[model samples]
Every structure is written in C-alpha cells, then in structure tokens.
Target chain A: MASSDILLSVRDLRIAFHGVEAVRGVSFDVRPREVLALVGESGAGKSLTARALLGMAPRGATVNGEIRLDGSPDLAAARGRRISLVPQDALSALSPVHPVGDQLAAAVRSVHRVSRREARARAVAALDRVGIPDAARRARAHPHEYSGGMRQRAVIAMATLNEPDLVVADEPTTALDAERREQVLRVLSEQREAVGAALLLVTHDLDVVRDHADRVLVMYAGRTSELGPTHTVLGQPRAPYTAGLLASLPQDGPRRRRLPTLPGTPPAPGELPPGCAFAPRCPLATDHCRSEEPETRELDGRLVACHHPDRIPDDTATLFEEEQPA
Target chain B: MTHLLDVRDLVVHYGTVTAVDGVSLTLEPGETLALDGPSGCGKSTTALAVLQLRRPDAGEVRFEGVELTSLTERELRPLRPRMQPVFQDPYGSLNPRHRIRDAVAEPLKVQGRWTEADGPTRVAELLDRVGLAPSYGARRPHELSGGQCQRAGIARALASDPRLLVLDEPVSALDPSVRAGVLNLLADLQDDLGLGYLFICHDRAVVRHFADRVVEMRDGRLVT
Candidate 1:
C-alpha cells in the first residue's frame, strides 16, 4: 500500500516511566485494512507502545517522538470513539456488575448522540457481528455469565462499536482455547475488513501473527529490532534475537532433540546495558555490540537495527535437524 | 505400571453451573495426558477436582489407589505434597516478596521436611534441574522473566517430589519461543523423574508435542 494509505506512522517513539525508558526510539507504520503485528516478549515495550498510541499510558509516564495518525488527528487527543483498545485480559476488562449490553451501549453512545434504545440495538448488532450466537440474550448477561471466548467477543464488540479508525489489541487471544482462539482471530480479521481499520496486534504468539498480520515488527528491550512484511521477517529473520525466537517454537509435528532456548533473560529497564539492550542474550553479539548501539538501516525493503544484520545460516538447519532422527 | 491418578465420573458444580460433568481420566506413571478444549470446557475444573481444590458434587478422585475426594482438608494435608500444581500465571502464582528459594521451599516447609541447613542446597538443585542458575534462588519473582518465573514454578512443583504434577496452562502466558523450552523442560523432567502430568492447555500444538495421549472436552463434558 502507498504511504497515503497508511493510517498510523510512528517515528523514533520513546517512552519512559520514572526515568526508566520502557520504549526506546521505535518506528513503524500501520496501513488501513491491514493487520500489523508488534511481536515481542513481555517487558519488551510492546504493550507500553500500544498504550501510548491510545493515550492510555500509566500516570507520570513520559512519551516523546513523532506519532502521526491519519487526517491530522492527534491520536493522543482523540477520544475512545476514534481509537479503542481490546485489552489482554477479557475477564478483568469487562465490568462484573453491569450487563455486557449496557457496557457495549455505553461505548456506542460515547461516540454518537444516540438514545438508550438505539444504543442497545447497536450493541446487539455489534455482538452479532462478532458471531455471538445468541447476541440479544448475551447482551443482557453480565461479564461473569459469559464464557472467556464470549467475553472476548463482547470486548471486541465494544471496541468496534464506534467503528474506530485504529484498534490496538494486546494479547487478545492469550486466554482462549485453540478453537476459540481461531474464532476470535477470525472475528478480528473480519472486523478489520468490514470496518476498513488498521490493526496494531500486539502479541507474543508467532502463530497468530504469521497467519494474520500483513506486516510484522520485532521488539526487544524497548526497541524495534526488525520490521518488514510478515512472511519475510518471520521466514528469514536478520536479527539474532528474532532468529532465536523463530528457532524456539515447536514444529507442527514431532521432534527429536531439545528445543532451542535463548541464553538469558531480557534485561530490566533500569538495568539495561549501555550498548545494545539485547547484547547479553543475542548469540551473534560482538564486542562492538556491547559498546555502541546499532542504527536502523534498510536492507531488502526491511528495517533492521543490528550491527550484523545477516540472517543466521544455521537457523533453518538447526530447526529442521531436530525434526529428523536416525 | 499402576495409574498415578485415576479420576472417575468427576462432576464439579459452581452453584447451579456444572463446571465439570462426569469427566473420567487416568494418568499413568511417566506419562503426560493433555486435556484440550475450548475455554470454560471443564478442563481447568477437572484439574482442580483431581487435586481436591474444588469439591466435586459427584465422582471419585483416586491418587495411587487412595480416594482423595473422601479425605477432609485436614486429612488431605499430607497428600498435598504427593500432588502439586504449576499454575498458569507464574508471576501471580509465586509471591513477589519471597525469593525463589523460599517459594520452592514453602512446600517442603509445609510438609515439615524443610530444615534451614538443607533448604538452600535443595533449592539450588531444583533450580539447576529446571535449567535456572543456582544464583536465581536468591532473586525475587519480580527479578525473573516470565519464562524464568515459570521455570521457578516448575522447580517449586518438583521440590515437593510429587508423583503427579497438575500443570494448568503452564506455558500459555509465555511467548511462543519460550513456550517450547518450558515444554521440553517438562518432558525431560517427566522422563527423568518418572512423574505423571495432567497437562491442561488450549494450545493444540503444545499438546501434540508434549502429550502422550490427548483428551478433548466440550462444555464440561469429555468429547474424546
């Protein structure tokens, strides 16, 4: 898609909490009608970046750098109607006291001046769109009454009630089962198509992103390590950390040897190493990587921020080797 | 080999809601049986009932030929060490204020097997077995990453020397990459220790990889 078709553009976005930089200078774009995945481990600043985009960052947090949304609309200034968040925990996100329908209707009324009756009708329709079998009845049920999958659907319905231009879904399918996960993902995909909205899907599941996201961004230690088309980035990751992540997933069938694991844990924000934040865990880190930070450079239509942006030659072999045994 | 756990016709109810209906399963020694199903399909409830954490309205939960359901809380206190749970949210499951050593040592302490002299050594060994550095025992839960916390949870579960470990969505909260490591660790631990696992999860991929047999559930009933 062309640059004009982009719904959101982030450049050198930095966010810090109490002098601890949670999100370093990170840049990416979300195109209209596209699913862009922000893939990273926990504490990698993915959630923080998503929260900053929707102006829901924690109190006393400082956000810097450029964030441009479509039509000159300052996303930070926009209300929930323009930009909505589908939180990770569906159980906690929905209020236990109120009926799900009432909660959804409130979202619809927030954006448009609608009567209570009209909002309820719209809420039922939204639930129906998300494939809640008995949408009308489900609308009247409280959060506790609904199953985890149904609760997630309710959350999605509320998020899309205003037909927001952008939706930031953080680990939306984490708590769902396999079948329910597929259903929830399908609903998300359908919503993106029907509403023609850009989606910033922040998740740790590569399988979810591999099939759903058109573009992918890899984040580590609060910085964007790699960004490119989903297939290209996942299939042939240039960064060592990205390659390690891809190597670590269990194959579809059976395997013989032990699964590959990254060496160490991600550094805490306050204790991040001076040079490259991932140097400690990165297998290909050199003395230079521990002394100077790498800059993002374009290589084959993808942005990679590594001093050695070469693909791991043995990654595919190592992954496949374990699949075959004598 | 005798079954480590035998759950027959397990029926658990939450008020008027039947969370687990007539669920029957068995875990043999050194085998991992995965319970796969959609959310709210009684998988978790079944796990809880097996551990007697939830009172089953009907059914029998027998561990090593002993009926667990018939035991009162006080009577079942000692049985706790024989069966342990590795919860999904490792961060939440472990106490933030306690060091990893203390979290793992809690089970031993509760069982009165933990002495100050041997607790540290045992904790270090458990951490090493779970692929964590011995030094990690001194660090608190907040100091470790999600995957490490999960490993620590597994270490704690193993510390009890349990014959059966009920792992509830053990790796669900972890990243896909880190997930494999934990799965492999569980598989290795089971093989080495000859432990039986009631592996409850929603991910088909992980189930297929780690489970010796798969049981599917739907709406509080077993489909397969």
Candidate 2:
C-alpha cells in the first residue's frame, strides 16, 4: 500500500510505567477504509496502545515512538480533527449532566470551529445517520434516557461527526448482545463506507473480529504475536498464542466437552521472565524460547513472532460455530 | 423421572415492566439446562424466580414436591439448602474483607451445620475440588485473580451441597484463557456430584457447549 493511503502509522511505539514497559516496541499501520483489529485479553496492552495514539495515555505513562498521520508530522495537534476515539463503555463514555446534542455539538466544534446552531444541526444529522429514531428529539435526552445500544450509537455518531481520517474503537460492541452486536457493527461498517476512514478496532472477542475485521493483529503480554489478514490468521495461525486463543473457543466438533486452554495466566507488568513472555504458558515452548526473545518475521503475507507456529488440521470452518450436537 | 425443581406459568414484574412473563420449566436430577437470551429478555429474572429469591407475581415454584411461591421465608428455610446460586460477579458477590474460608463456610453456618471439628477440613476440601490450592482459603477476594475468585465462588456454592445450581453468566467476566478452565471445572463438578445446573447466559455458543437442554427467551417471554 502507498504511504499516502495509510491514515496512521506507528514505528517502535512503546509505553513504560516507572521503569516497566507495558507496550513493548509495537509497530503497525492502519490504511484508509480498512478495519484493523487488535485482539488480546486483559493486560495485553491493546487499550493502552490505542489511548496513547490519541494522546490519552494512562497517568504517569511514558510513551516513546514515531507516530505520523499522513502528511502531518504532529499527531497530538490533529487528534480530534484527524483521529478520534470510540470508547468501550458507552454508558459512562458520554457525559451524564449535559444533553447528548450538546456533547455531539462539542465534538463537532472541537475539530471545526463551527457556530453553535450549525454544530447542533450537524449533530442531529450525525445521530440520524447512526440509525437512532427521531434524532432531533433523542438528541435532547440525557445519557441515562437511551438504552445500551442507543447509547453506543450516540457515541459512534459523536466520534464520526467530523469525519476523521482514523477512528480508534476500543471494544465498541462489547456491551451489546448478539442482536445488538450485529446492529452496532452494521452502523460502524456503514459509517466507514460513508466516510472513507480507517478503523483501529481493539477488542477481545475473536468471533466478532473474525467476521468484521479486514486484518487482524494478535497481541500477547504487551508484544505483537501475529499480524495478517483475518482469514489467514484465524484459519492458519502462525503464532502459538494466536492458536491457543483460537482453540479456546468452543469448536464445531462432535462433542462440547472440555475446551483446549492455555495453562498459565497472562503476565502482569514487571512480572515477565527472561525471554519470550508467552513461553510460560505455550505448549510448544522449548529451551530456546525460554532464553531468547523472538523477532517478527515476514512469512506468507503475514508477520509472526514465535519459535514454532501451528496450522490447525482439517481446515476448520469458523470459530464459535452456533451449535454442535452432543 | 421426577424433576428436582419445577416452575409453571412463572410471571414476574418490576413495577409493571414485566421482566419475566409466563415462563415454565423443570430440571431433572443430574441434568443441565441452559437459558439463552439477550439483555432485558428475562433470562435472569426467570432464573431468580426459580430460586424463589424473587417470588413470582403469578406462578408456581415447586421444589421436591413442595410449592415455594406460597411458603413463608421461615417455612422455606428448611428447603433452601436444596437450591443454591452462583452469581456473575466474583468480587461483588463475595465479601472483599473476609477470607475465602469464611465466605465458603457462611452458608453452612447459616444452616447450623458448622462444626469446628470438620468445618476447616471441609472448606479446604472444597477449595481443592475446584482446582485451587487449599492454602488459598486464607486470601481475600481482591487478593486473588478473577479465575481464583470464581473458583472460590464455586467452592462456596458447592458448600451447601445443593442438588441444583443456578449459575448466571459465570464466565462472562473472565478472560478467554481463564474461561475454559472454569467451564471445565463446572463440567467436572456436574459429573462427579450428579448436580443439576440452570445455566443462564447471553452467548449461545457457551450454552451449546456447557448445557444439555437449551431454553430461549426474548422480550420477557419464551420463544417456541
């Protein structure tokens, strides 16, 4: 892909807290009109990395990296106008005291210095675009008035009001169920199509990512495990951790017995041992894995970091299949 | 075969909202029944009525051939040990300040089954049975990880030795790697103890794997 087509690019991005690194040397790119998913469990440093991209890192975090947006050298200055955030928890993400219209209007004015009347009109149009019924009347209601799904739509509307080039959504559909999950994902995909914006989706739900994300980035213990197209990575995972995550989902086999699980817990900050962070729990870990950290290597249109990679036998259909008979 | 628990035409409401409307179900001994539905769909509300925690507005809850909806709290005490609940949030359901041993033994103490001679040993055994070290009983809930806290919750639920367990989204809050272990533990407990499970969840994938029979709910009513 051309450099101009890439909306956001990061090189050697690292976040440290009091001498301990939380996000270690992460690097990637998000192209225009593409959905790039960053998948990981708790303490995987996905959220921290996303927050740092928008100049909203956790308190006392030390971020060191080269983050460039298209032609702009300064990313922090063009945060709202060029890049925006769609937070995980929609209920508390929007302000409680003010009307949603005002919040949306404020977001619009943050990027473009439009008049209040024009901003309000644009806010209503944005809310209507996100499929909220009676956008004009609903915009007048407070955050508490809307349902869970409605609140998420309002958040999305505000984030995309200015048509930013890049939208960093951290677990956007986590709070919704299967039915609402589909609705929110449709809104997001449609919004992406309407406004030619790149999406950086950070989430733990592998099932959602398999269907929605165009590309996938697997993270483990603050390090990049695997990066490839969604189908390639899920069908034939090149990293051990990625395979473990895929295997953890209930497969479409003959029986729904015990699931294959990774043995140990995710390492916390400062708790990582010598060598690869995932070596403690990986089934294929060897002596070399325990002593030397692996580097990302390009292979088969993907980047993988591991001593031994795996390709599932029989080419499974998909992860999280609806039902398997007993 | 006689069912250990039965509910007929169960209807529950919260200020005319109708959280659960006309739900009927039964659980046979050693059987696993999963309830699948979205939020605000009355899966949780229906499960609550099964335990008689929320007395139904218009329905019948019979446990071991006795109706619970019509019984007083005092009259229901003797039959309470037959049904137990394992909540969703491990941190909130348990007392943070109290040790794991005390939390696991509280149910036994309530039923006047606590004996200094066997209480400690039974608590350790329960912890071990749930794949936790016996020494973990000395730690508080906050001191343990999400997986450990959930195991402690299971230990406490199993302390009552109930024939039926009502688990509400037991593993939703846990991480994926940790999720399978907990689910496996639940499966093992069900097999070993001949326990009946009323598994309530929003994810049908988990329900299909963990439960023997599936019940679907939507808009406060069961669908087909």
Candidate 3:
C-alpha cells in the first residue's frame, strides 16, 4: 500500500504507565474504508492501542512514537473531525439526562458550525441510517428509554455524525448477545460504508474478526503476533500464538468432546518474559525463542513475529490432535 | 427413577411482564442440559427459580424428588448446598474483599460443616481440583486473572459438594483461550462427580459443543 492510500499510520507506537510499557513498539496502517481488526486476549493492549489513536490513552500514561494521520501528527486537533471512537459501553458513551437526538445534535455542533436545527436534522438522519426504527420519535426520548440494541445504534450514530475519516470501535459488540452482536456489526458496517470511513475494530472474538475484518493485527502482551489479510492469516496462521488461538475456537462442524486449547495463560503486562512474550505459552518455543525477541518481519506473505514461523503447520489442528478426545 | 432436575410449567413474572412462562425441562443424573437463548429470554430467571433464589409465580421445581417452590425458606436451606450457581461475571461472583481461601471455605462455614483441622485442607483440595495453585488462595479477586478468578468461583461452588450445578453463562465473559480451559475443567468435574449441569448460555456454538441436549428459549418460552 502506498503512503497516499494509508488513512492512518502508526509506527513503533508505545504506551506505558509509570515507566512500565504496556503497548510496546506496534506498527500498522489503516487503508481507506477498510476494516482493520486488532485481536488478542486480555492485557494484550489492543484496547490501549485503539485508545492511543484518538489521543484517549488513560491519564498519567506516556505515549511515544509516530501516529501520523494523513501526514499530520496532530491527532488532538483531528479528533472527532478526522477520527471518532465508539466505546465498549454504549450506555456510558451516551448521557442519561439528555434526549438521544439532543446528545447527537450536540456532538454534531461540537466540530461543525451548523445551526441547532440542522444539527438536530442530521442527528435524526444519522439515527435512521443505523436502522433505529421510528428514529424521529425515538430520538426525542432519553437513552434510558431505548433498548440495549437501540442504545448501541445511537452510540454508533453519534460516532459517525461528523463523518470522520476513521472510526475506532473498541469491543463495540462484546456486551451484546450473539444475535445482537451480528446485528450491531451489520449496522456499524452499513453506517461506515454510507459515510465512506475506515474502521479500526478492536475485539477478542476471532469469529467476528474473520467475518468483518479486511486485515487483522494479532497482539500478545502488547506486541504484534501476526498481521495480514483476514482469510490468509486466519485460514493459514503463520504465528504459533495465532495458530493456537484459531484452533481453540469452537468450530461449526461436528461436536468434539474437547476443544484444542492453548495451554497456560497470557502473561500480564509488566510481568512479561525476557524474550518473545508468547514463548511461555507457544508450543514451538525454542531456546533461541526464549533468549531473543523476534522482530516483526514479513514471512509467508504476512508479518509474523516469531523465530520459527516456518515450523508452524498449515493445519493448526495437528498441533492439538493428540489432545483431541478419541 | 426421578430426574435430577424436573422443572414443570415454570412461570416467572415481573409485575405484569412474564419473564419465564411455562418453561419445562428435565436433566438426568450426570447429564448436561443447556438452556440456550438471547438476552431477556428468561434463561437466568429460570436458573434462579431452579435454585430457589427467585420464587417462580407458578411452577414445580423438583430436585431429587423434592418440590422446592412449595418449600419454606427454612426447609430449602439444607438443600441449597446440594445445588449451586456459577454466574457469568467471575469477578462479580466472588467477593472482592475476601481471599480465595476464605471464599471457598465460607460455604462449609455457613452450613456448620467447617472444622479448624480439616477446613483449610478441604479448601486447598477444592482449589487444586479447579486447576488453581495453593498460593492463589492467598490473593483477593482483583489480584487474580479473570480465568483464575473464575476458577476460584468454581472451587467455591465445589466446596459445597453439590450434586447439580447451575452454570449461567459460565465462560461467556472469559477470553476464548481461557474459556476452553474452564470448559475442560467443568467436563472433568462432571465426569468425576457425575454431577448434573443446567448450563444456561447464549452462545450457540458453545451450547452445541458442551450440552448433551439443548432447549432453545425465546421471549420467555421454549422454541423448537
């Protein structure tokens, strides 16, 4: 991808608190109108990385490295105008006091010099676009009156009201159930396409990443594990951690007595191992893997950070075949 | 023989709204019966009714040939330990201020079964069975990871020596990697103890994989 094609460029970005790094040297590019997913287990710093894009890293945390948006490093000024954030909790993102439409109108007026009537009109239209039924009348009610799914749609409408170049959704559908999760994702994608904005989706659900993401950036202990096109990476993972994660997922085929679990837990931030952070849990870990940190390099048509990417089999199921119940 | 859990015509109403209407289910001993549904479908409500935490408006919840809905709170007290609940949010299930050791031992203590000599040993055993190390018992809920905290919650549930476990979205809040470990632990425990599981979850994939038989619920009623 050319520099001109890149909507957002993050290079060697690091986020830390009290001198302990949590997001360490991660790099990625979000192309125009593309869905780039950041996937990992808890404490992977995927959320922190997503937050850093909008300059919303928690207070007292230090962020270092380059975060250029269309050749400009001024993310602070670009917030809400060029970039928007749809947080995990829709209820928290919206205010309980104001009417749903009023809050969205306020958001519209926050960046643009539109009149109150125009802002309100755009808010209702935005609500309609996200498939909130009876959006006109429903907009007059408080957020407390709307259902959970409706509140989520209202939050998405609020995020895209300004028609930003990029929208960062951090676990947007995690709180919802299976049916609602798919519905919200559908509405989000529809709204994104309508606005012509790229999406930075941060989620731990691999199935969601598989279905929606154009490209995936797998993170582990605040470092990139694998980065590539969704099908290519998920179908044939080049990294051991990615393979283990994909294999562990409950497939839609015949039911098995046991799932292929990756043994042990992800190491917590600040308690990371010396070398490759995933070495402790990875089945392919070697003495070299334990001693030397693997740099993110192109391998098998994708970026993988592992010493033995070649050792990982195309069929991840083989790694756990012995553990499979006969 | 009577079923391990026999819930018939279960009806739970919140004011005018019916939360669970005429929901019926049965589970044999050592069987896994899943109640699969979307949110607000009364899965949790049914579980609560089964455990007698929330009294159903109309129903017969027979556990081991005993109808629990008609039982007095005092009468139900002794049978409470025989059936336990493992909830969705692991962190919320365990008390934040209590140590894992104390949390697990509380059940024994509450039922007047705790002894100074054997209580600590029993708690440690429970923790070990749940794949938690002995040292983890010293930590509070916040200090442990989500998966470990959930294990502590399971160990606490096990301390009661329950025959039936009501698992409501047990692994839904956990990451995929951690969820598999917990599911494996549940399977192993069921195999060893022959415990009946009333598994309530919204994830269809997990339900299909884990449950021997699954009943779908929608709008407070069972669907085909």
User: Top TM-score: which candidate number?
Assistant: 3
The 10 consecutive residues of candidate 1 chain B with the worst lDDT sum are: B202-211
CAPRI grade of model 1: medium
Task: List, residue by residue over A222-286, the lDDT tens digit for candidate 1.
Answer: 99899999988888887777787877776665644366666567888888897888888776778
The CAPRI quality class of candidate 2 comes to medium
Off by over 4 Å in 2: A71-73, A310-326
Writing each residue's lDDT as its tens digit, candidate 2 over A68-120 gives 88856598777877788889899899999999999999988877778999999
Q: Indicate the residue-level lDDT of B145 in model 1.
A: 81
> What lDDT score goes with residue A221 in model 3?
90
Superposed Cα deviation of residue A142, candidate 2 (Å) = 1.2
Q: Distance from true position, residue B15, model 1, in Å?
A: 4.6
lDDT measured at residue A118 in model 3 versus the true structure, 0 to 100: 96
Provide TM-scores for the models: 0.92, 0.94, 0.98
lDDT of 3: 0.92
C-alpha RMSD values across all candidates: 2.9, 3.2, 1.3
Model 3 — TM-score against the truth?
Answer: 0.98
In Å, residue B16's CA in model 2 sits off its true spot by 1.9
DockQ score of each predicted structure, in the order shown: 0.62, 0.69, 0.79
